[model samples]
Target: MNILITNDDGVYADGIFELANKVKAIANVYVVAPDSEKSAIGHAITIHNPLMVKKVNFRNTDIDAYAVSGTPADCVKLGIEAILEDIHIDLVLSGINNGPNLGTDVIYSGTVSGAMEGLVQNKPSIAISYDGKNISSKEYEKGAEYVVQFIDKIKDNLTMLDDTMININIPDIRDTKINGFKVTQLGIRRYENTFEKRIDPRGNIYYWLGGKTVELEQDENSDVTAIKNGFIAITPLKYDLTHYDRIGRIMKEIQPLDI
Candidate 1:
């Protein structure tokens, strides 16, 4: 299997490095990630600016890697559109992200967006993430190991029709045993957006975007709830934002007259 890997945490991030090291044994791995952290960058592409790509070495890991000066989505786009057009990429795995992509967190996750890009092009993909920032590099080794074990079971059976891209979040507790996996839905993450006003040396007013206070509602099958309860959360997400269930009801309220 030919697997294309990328992440939002840049080329040097331990999470991506651990992921690559583990998956290399399962397939031909290619790493094309951002040159620097591009967190919360959504699904953006570098259409107006020139994008750059440079080869990078992951000290101990003998794998093909590249650093891209672009958003996470752009890396995957460029990987397929330009970099590996000749190579038959069977799967695109994004992240083992530094932080969790739970709930509607997927909307702002560059990690999930990277995988979404591959799924958009009809390729099988998966996005992996760690729930807590306190998780050590050694902990990621365990998470990636589990990912390899999980992939080995599903890789050959995974068709484009069966599973496209799913967001997977692992808990951060080093000794906490995983209860198992849950097929979850996206949870609602309540946000308190605050912009802190500041003055630069040039005496210009600037605002720094602040972190959100995350609160998950009690939904048993939600990704947030699953992660909070010590199970690995696996959510099958789609790029289509259409609210199909509401379309019929909305159409009935808007009557069209013959003109």
Candidate 2:
């Protein structure tokens, strides 16, 4: 299989490196990622500014890699349209991210957004993240190993889909301690936003953004709860944001006559 990989943690992050090496054993891997970290960038693309691309040898891995000077979405877009147009890319994979993209975190995750872009283009895609434990660094060998195992499990079905995407979150723990995988739903994972006021040497006051993770009490099927209980969370996602269940019932309550 031909797999295209990208991540928000830059082309040199250990998570992406580990993932590339591990997945290469089963597929032809091509990585196009930001030259530097672009965390929490969401689904942004570099339309106004020109994107710079450079070929680089992935350390300890003989996979094809490109460092892009843009967002994670930009890397995937450029990879498909400009770089690998001649090659048949069967799957678009993102992450093995440095942090967990759980629940509402996906709303601000470039890792998920990278895979989302591929899904938007009707390609089979999956976004994988390792629970970061609030720490910025991660040892992704075990997580990467699990991801390869996941690929082996689902590799046959990748070519059979056109409009679906999957999100995988691995716990930040020892491999042997991991319980198993759970198909989960989005949980009420949120953040308590804060800003700290401070004065610099120039006597100017400024506020820096800060927040703490907050997970609301949810059912056991929630992704947050699954990870908390030591299971890898797998969520099937779609690009449609419509509240379809409410539309018909809501329309019945009001009459519209060019009002």
Top of the candidates by TM-score: 1
- Clashing residue pairs in candidate 2 (N, C-alpha, C atoms within 3 angstroms): none
How does residue 68 of candidate 2 score in lDDT?
96
- Tens digit of lDDT per residue, candidate 1, span 35-99? 99999999998999999999888766778898999998899888988888899888899988988
The superposed Cα distance between candidate 1 and the true structure at residue 46, in angstroms, equals 0.8
Give the per-residue lDDT of model 2 (tens digit) for 45-110: 988999999999899567889999999899989999998889888889899788789988898999
lDDT of each prediction vs. the true structure? 0.86, 0.87
**Which residue runs does candidate 1 get wrong by more than 4 Å?**
160-163, 201-203, 257-259
The RMSD of every model to the true structure, in order and in angstroms, is: 1.9, 2.2
Candidate 1 lDDT: 0.86
What is the Å distance of residue 242 in model 2 from its true position? 0.8
Q: Per the 3 Å backbone cut-off, how many clashing residue pairs does candidate 1 have?
A: 0
